[model samples]
Target: MLDLRSQAAATRRAADRVGGLTHHLTLAAAATLESVARSQLRKAQVDPVLELASNASTAEINEARRRRSVRRGQDVYLPSWREAAVGLPNLFLRSALFSVCSAREVLVDETIATQGDTVITMTGVQLWNYDRRMFAACLNYYRDDRPLSSSAEHPWVKVSLWQLAQDLKVSYGANVHKAMRESLIRLNAAHLRIRVKRQDVPMPRLIDVAFDDGYLGRDTPAPLLRGSDTVAFRVLDSMANLFGPSDWSAISDTALHERSGLSSWLTGYYSTHAGPFKLAVAALHQYSGSICELREFRRRLKNALLALEGEDIPTDCRIASPEISLLL
Candidate 1:
């Protein structure tokens, strides 16, 4: 009887937490949409559409207009991290890499990734969630620009750490600053080897094309980062190619901020293709961040699917766990 009562209380608490999160996410999504609409309106040279004649269709027309405006004004481009090639959620840890929360240095010549015919190796370094955010931020920064050739001076992009923290919905603190610095170190020290079918591109480390201004070494200065500090980094040839607009994915800021990293990655991947996409449960596990064991992951995935149903968010995808299919 005591066990039963404990389970019931736990269930109620979980329900309450989910409800609160859902409400907060809903409000955030609405605010983002409103901001986007206002920005579009200000940028418009003239009224977007004819004032519709019938009052009955006015709501429908406005909704349609809003959808079109969002597509036009608020599109954020992201580079594709396809699972078959690079591995899904490209920077996350698999069971083979390290413990879920550990920051231990990976040994040199470690096989960090094995996708299709490609096998990527890395040195002793840890890639954390903050590193993932930093990379995404950099990619988004240069999304609209053309990738420069090998000879051109690398384009330097300057961004304030505070603004980046806000965009990522991460708290700004000394630890955050340290995390950012560590991310740069890990990324710079990493290497990649790509082999597709029978062909191979020369393997290259990320550092070949990217590096910070002057903060990598210990002698740089104390408080290596600050809210007001602006860091400028140049994107070189290979780096530009890495972030180049080949096949791209789109993930909304609200989705990234509100959902788990796995969910956000799944959303981005699904957004790339039209669904009712069918796949096995194993593939879903592999593609999403490999955090939880299968049983727990399935439970979490089911809840995500249920919560998404009939929600007013932008995704057209509907997920059902029993069938293991996503209908978009």
Candidate 2:
């Protein structure tokens, strides 16, 4: 309890600092976005060309065949911000969905579903879920200062200025919100020469590191963690000091199994690395401590697995969860 209390305090401090920055950055983005919208509207009114014309048509996608067919010194060049701006209309529609987050709502229309009057039925559970995801993004970026992966899937639903005030109904214990804050701060720091539907606009932009790293356009994923040698060494040194360990053996099995201990520590630590996540999973390996925790955790995971049974959730997709755990 004391540890959680301290964590709550520290998390609050971390969140406040990031959230303060995020608030200002988001305000700035709102202004910039309004200007961009007006500019886009003007362009649309003036230009009749929609989609790419024969003269302007670049390759629509990065294809293996296309890669093999490119001529020497004439590789296909896409507008730098190819898909970063693709989600604007979708984002605008989703904003309306978030606007209606009331306790009276039952089932959430998480996806916009269609382009019509988007009224999402927000449940308490879904609201809490959205809140947690936002808190995670803020903390993930601010305190952890980590790069985000596509898997991270930080929510981009910007609550309008009025809606934001309402969304602040809950305070503290908010990882997702912290991540949102950090992501916003990062976005506000970068300028993108975006070509949305063939018009150039230099705007402050936010993109998932996957997109920013050229995952979609370039097709190869980029590293999600960035740090200098000194920073990396300091992180290692900090982990050693915090857990009072240099190696796996030094961390007691019991200390590891305690959710408040190593496992929790590594959930934030080595968050992007399969190896450290493996180590954390191994720490849970010998845990025969309680049937209830195992059952609850396993049941939740099983349900999640079932949802993705026919979906592409991994590299090879041949192995199941426990089998993957064995590899861990």
Candidate 3:
């Protein structure tokens, strides 16, 4: 009986020691967790200066964080300043949708090569370099400086006609305002049909909208403005999708606005490429959407290439008989 009682007492002592060790381990684990949580909280804290600059509400900040966590990739945002540069889709730059000619009404239905076996069928009024500038200015106003949760169907901006003209470096007058309004209408009328065979993706239109002058809905025409009259410009989801990190290039605003005709087009085209590459002059001519004869285009191309060089864009034009090519 005595031996059995001694053994039982030893067992109880062992169990007590085990319980004490377990309690210490649990407390240690809880302390470590608290420390880690505090560290994370500090790291997640928002900078007050950045918060002020963005002018975002607390709910907006939380929503942006949630969206960023859920999205697969980072969002591409435009620069804050107009003079810095603007993000333009590579597909727009590489194709002949914007014709390198004077503003004229056009009806086109043609297939243009882009990526491997990917062709874009464009059908709309022939857009000019001037229109391209106007489109860029609109994008400038749609800068994503703050976390903007907009409808995926259409993201829009409201800016005065005078502001747009200033961004385009044009004198804002009654006549200029009328012309700008017409240009936006033309841009909205254009359409692009992208057929991607490799990925089996088909897209409908490039940009699917026009401007809305405040007084247009009541069956009354809005008068031409001196300034300060706002117009709503909306961009389609597909068009907005092109602004993704991989699909667009930052084009120099100064270079684009300074040059005109083929030179202006070249500014955008070369901006898409990182370095110079050889391309046939014939292909360039077709891509430029120039109505000039091939021979005449070659002459103009040479001059345009020189002008681009002056704008700090390096180029080499090889005038060989069999085929003319450019290292742009």
Model 3 TM: 0.63
Top lDDT prediction, candidate number: 3
Tens digits of per-residue lDDT for model 3, 129-246: 8888878877765454432223554345677878888888888876677778767777877667764422322345433344545434333444635477767665543344343334
Kindly report which residue stretches of model 3 are placed more than 4 angstroms away from their true locations once superposed. Answer: 1-83, 112-116, 146-155, 200-224, 311-328
What TM-score do all the candidates reach, one by one? 0.54, 0.20, 0.63
Residues 1-328, model 2: lDDT tens digits: 3343454445445454566777566555555555665665665443211123234333442231121111112222211111111101221221222222223233422332222232222222222223222333222221211212222233332323222222333332234233333333333333322233333433222332211211122222324211110100001111111111111111122212222322222222222223422333322322211123544645443444343333453322212343434433
Q: Write the per-residue lDDT of candidate 1 for residues 1-328, one digit (tens) a residue.
A: 3343455445555455566777566555555555665565555423212233344253543344322211122121123332221211222222122222335566677665322344445564755444555555555554332332233454456667676676567888656655666675666666655333233434354532333333546455646656766665543344322222222244455544455445544554555544455655565665453557888777766666666554565553433333434421
Q: What TM-score does prediction 1 earn?
A: 0.54
Lowest summed lDDT window (length 10), candidate 3: 66-75
Each prediction's Cα lDDT score? 0.46, 0.27, 0.59
- Give the winner by lDDT: 2 or 3: 3
How many clashing pairs in candidate 3? Answer: 0
- Maximum-TM-score candidate: 3
Tell me the spans in candidate 2 whose CA falls farther than 4 Å from its real position.
1-129, 136-271, 275-292, 306-309, 312-328
Ranking by TM-score: 3, 1, 2
